[model samples]
Target: MNRKILVLFLLILLSQNIFSATRIKTVEFNFGGYYSATDIASGSAWTPPYIIVNLPETGIVIKNAYVEIEYLSSAGSAADVTNIDIYFNAGTSATDIVDNITGTQVPDSSGESNLFVARADVTSKITSWTNQPYSLKFVSVGSPHNMHSAKLYITYEYDDTSPIQIKTVHFPIFSDSLDGISGVISTLAQQISPVSVPFKYRCDLPESGITIRQVWFEIRGLRQSGGATTDGSINVNISGYSSEPTMTLDGALTDTYRFRYLSSTGTPAGFAPNTLQTVYVNLSGTANTNILGGEVVITYEYSNNSNVKLKTVSYFFAQSTGTAGSVTSFTVPVYLNEDGITIERIYAKISGSYDSTTVGSIEVNSAIAGNSLTSRIYQIVVTAAQISGFEFYHDLSEGRSYWYNGAPITISWTNTLAALGGCAVELFITYKYTSENKYTEFYRVFAGQTPNEVASAGVYNYTFNLFFPDPEYPVGRKVLRRTWLRGDFIEG
Candidate 1:
């Protein structure tokens, strides 16, 4: 029975050892030390001894080790202090040299403490120690371990006073894979919409005191996706208006506006297939001066991972301006016609006054010989009370002449003027004859005149007039023409 019991006990011990080997428990060696100059003899000639500490016993071993040292300013005043060497020893004395190691030293010009590092052979030592069991020691040359039980060392002249000390720190090993994985995943998601945000603007009364006639919106998207690493995993789309009309003192009308998108963020990108993409709208018209209100819309689409996507939209509107008086010079297009001739060109002379201090712009359109002659458009602010008008000229005449007997020449004109307060004006149409052969045949004919009335501030009526030239002039190889109203006044 005793022999059988001994054999059973041996079997149980062997099973326990096998079980311990199969279960892995990770362990690390961390050490830290510092030396204070106050602990050393002030006037004695002595070198601090280097010291090293061994790690705890564990089934898992030290995989890696990092050592850093900080020097205290009070340690020494000697500027000649230069070299510092460190070594790893297997035993407690200098003879047991496990590995010869050196630390990187830095200069301290300000007499302040600096840091040093001993990193060579660290990886190889870690690999060997982790595979088996080993001991480690930290040793210094001129600097000795001053503390009674500390691993740090300091060396300096006793008479060369200033407090001197050394500090050593050791880092503990932990699981980096678990901590780093979350950060990597977060970084990957941030790249998808790094700059995808909506933008907004408003129309307000600036210090300059000028009512904004129109507003324009421009938007651009920078692409941050595509490459071997990114793999074109992201896509973006944008759509928005250039300008949306707002209610002004008068009414709403299409005004000046533009929107554009490009491939590159620098200049306008050229339109190409499978390159950059863009969408834009230009909203421009006369603002409604009477009831101040208006709005514009913008939309976008974002795609990541080809299967995941997002959409966003936004809008902007106009604010109201509190003022009084009927808007005169309401924005409108003027029209005109000339009878009994082939109309070559038609000019409308305008005369008016506006209470608003700002100048206004004018637009014109016309037709001739069954062809739409709508190319001559002009814009100018009415400042001085001179004659402001629209002129229409044809590039190619449809074999039609303005001077034929009883030829009914038709002329059309349209005008748009902007201003504030009640406005009243008179427009005059003038006609002239021009030919390549004779510079002396140019003259004016019967002129047509009319008056315009403004019902509200910032609003005016666009007037159209027609005229027929007198039949008493010589009819052979000549043109017939008429002139409309021309004059001016001041707005109240």
Candidate 2:
């Protein structure tokens, strides 16, 4: 009996050590709001203003992030290809536009026409912060298009040492067209009154053994018509879950967004698991106000139970405008703490101007590892007309993986065409490996950031701070992970 007890004690110790080692685990969260069958009119500005997606907070490390939108275009014909303009965070923050996209319409099983899907590589936008809200807007260019739905997928990694693990669920409440056009008695335009719009959605939280961390909701793209009389306000709340003035909308709320956040940190009641609750909203506001879209995001945090963790980091490189006909090569420095890192994806914003109406082209390429081109990473050939720009985000998984050795990740831009001049590029790369000593690092470029760090003859300093508190290993420890720097020229 004594011999058996000794062997069992040793086995338990060995297992604990193995599990405590740094490990990585990946997770993907999908949520969105805004589903409409009503065809948006041509030249409609960002209809259904935005769809909200809640992301994991600091303890979780994002490995890869992207957004996919599915919609219907060319409703009459199945063979017609329609060009649609998609904007991300439009008229809000981090506004990005992708225009002139020709989406091929496919036929469904019923032989119906016009189904389009578009994707955007939003790794940089999504991973920049934690527990933040993201919104997407759509614009119809050629013809009227029906927006089916919008969703966000975030793939992240976490480990045992993380203070907490987070999971989010989005319950879409009140997604319908509301036209407050005064004197227009249309079915779509409903008058604002108490109990005018009584909205409710069935919310079934996860029944698993988890604790509620935080809960929040957002009202997106609440704008008035072209001509309005007074400001607009809407009081929305979830029964038994909302506080006084759940969301206050009072201002030049034209094309604006609003949100409300509640956490256990301040509320003494402490949020309880609200399972099988029917959330209700009572919207009463001023007259002649148009509402585009809205969504509710609920985030839950609990003690991290996983022993594995993973992360993805990005480095930014900004290139200067090149000569008329030349290939400029940029050598991006390595600032990662670990050696032998592998890059997973590269996103580039290529810009140039064209004087003539003739077609022009820009060639961008990248090679990693050895100087002899051990790994051919990515190459993009963009052909544009008159004046246009390209935002190309490419994944390097097609080629064999090559280890980075603190050498410059070579990026070149060839703009030899005469029609296009002033070629420039902004590049960002996401790595595959996670740094054991860091969680996240930030870099910012500014002028006169400090008394000593001032600009000198058109040269400025990128000043930043790093703080990581490692109380103990494999436990309560915070570390610096990734960093990026981007700057714009002045007096342009």
Candidate 3:
């Protein structure tokens, strides 16, 4: 038996369940076209993004684990159809397995030319396949010239479980405090995303934790506290999909819109467990003039080896930068603990407005200036006619001593309305700090808009955006006009 063995590797990387869907595929490949004696990466349908999809449960039999090996025998002479041997765990070299299954081909006519098809039963190995990668090897013997490989059949059942889980939900309330020198965070503020922003969430998906059935982006319409209702459609945009889905607006979600990507061909390199994935949501669409803010949600379904559940998660994107002429800004916090960590950099989302007709310019400046580390003065002209937004990044690594005791930095934005209303001013600060050696803790700040930041010092929250019957502007806006200075200081 001058046996010729073929080795192939298949990738059946599963995705997090986003929708309720299942996929069963017959992975196929050719040895003569793929199995190379020396070259590792020559030809392979046995490569990644080309494997079988199964559940996480152990001892589940996959009824579709079989191979249909095809080879043509020339007319006359020593050409004959042989038997097929199936093995688990395919490799790059010729190897023999102790536990193997075999199947024979219905012999084709030796007197005439014919195509030999061999069906091998591989259910024995599949019934107890591991959560790890599993591939089948097919061996065809009995002196057949020009032996090639064919398609593999797999029966995969989609469990269709919930895509996301609400691990925890923080309340809308916020609080903060000063610990010795540094501010100890008691209850951090809730993060809010502004309108027209593709606020992205770094999705943390568990390895093989859940297979993604379907994925969708949902954005709800925004309205003020006891404000007028909006009827017009809120336009939105979404990127980074396997295949962009169609758009639709209906019901209360009429102000809302949803999109789902159908194909789950995204590789293991994409949905590996314990890795961060990108889910971007942008409101580049038209704004509902009557709305104040909107909520962003990523809805999906998944399989957990047994059952499927529909799940939705509220992500890191939440902010309502309504019309240009409205008071649309709040302050976030910057805290550095006393862990001897060096302060390095900081970022902030600066946004503001004045009236429904006229607005002002927003400027971000610091008391301490590093020729290299200090962020430049950010200024933007605001108006009812224009929406102002600027991303401010400043490096605190230069010209400042490393923050050893952790302190607080106030980021303030000052805007003067062109209208007769009290100057509607808003502000936000940047926290640029760092640590030399990895301290007790290490985390990165964000380019963000905080609805609030909770601290251990004490809970003292305030809102001055009150309304009264005013002549110049009937809809009274918040006038928080204040001075700002940037500096680096040590807390004792």
The candidate that achieves the highest TM-score relative to the unseen native structure: 2
Predicted candidate 3 versus true structure: per-residue lDDT over 1-492, tens digit per residue: 222222221212121212212222222221211211121111111221233333443322243444444433321123343443434443333233322223222232233223333344344444432323345444434433222333334443322233322111011100121211111111111222224333322232322344442222222222111111222222333334332222211111121111111112222123222222332323222322221211122222233332211211111111333433544333332232222333322223222223332223334333223122233332222222221121222212233352233233333333343431222222211122122111111111111111222233433232211111111233322221221211111010
lDDT of 2 at 358: 33
Error of 2 at 304 (Å): 6.1
Candidate 3 vs. true structure, TM-score: 0.25
Tens digits of lDDT, candidate 1, 273-326: 112223222112221011011111111111111221111110011111212332
Write down the TM-score for model 2: 0.36
Residue 298, model 3: lDDT of: 20
Q: What's each prediction's TM-score?
A: 0.19, 0.36, 0.25
Considering TM-score, which of the candidate structures 2 and 3 is the better prediction for this target? 2
Query: Least lDDT summed over 10 consecutive residues: which range in candidate 1?
Result: 4-13
Error of 3 at 90 (Å): 46
Task: Give the least accurate 10-residue stretch of model 3, judged by summed lDDT.
Answer: 166-175
**Error of model 2, residue 274, in angstroms:** 33
lDDT of model 1 at residue 459? Answer: 35
**TM-score, model 1 to reference:** 0.19
Ranking by TM-score: 2, 3, 1
Candidate 2: tens digits of C-alpha lDDT, residues 223-278: 22222222343444445655323222222212111112121112112223333232
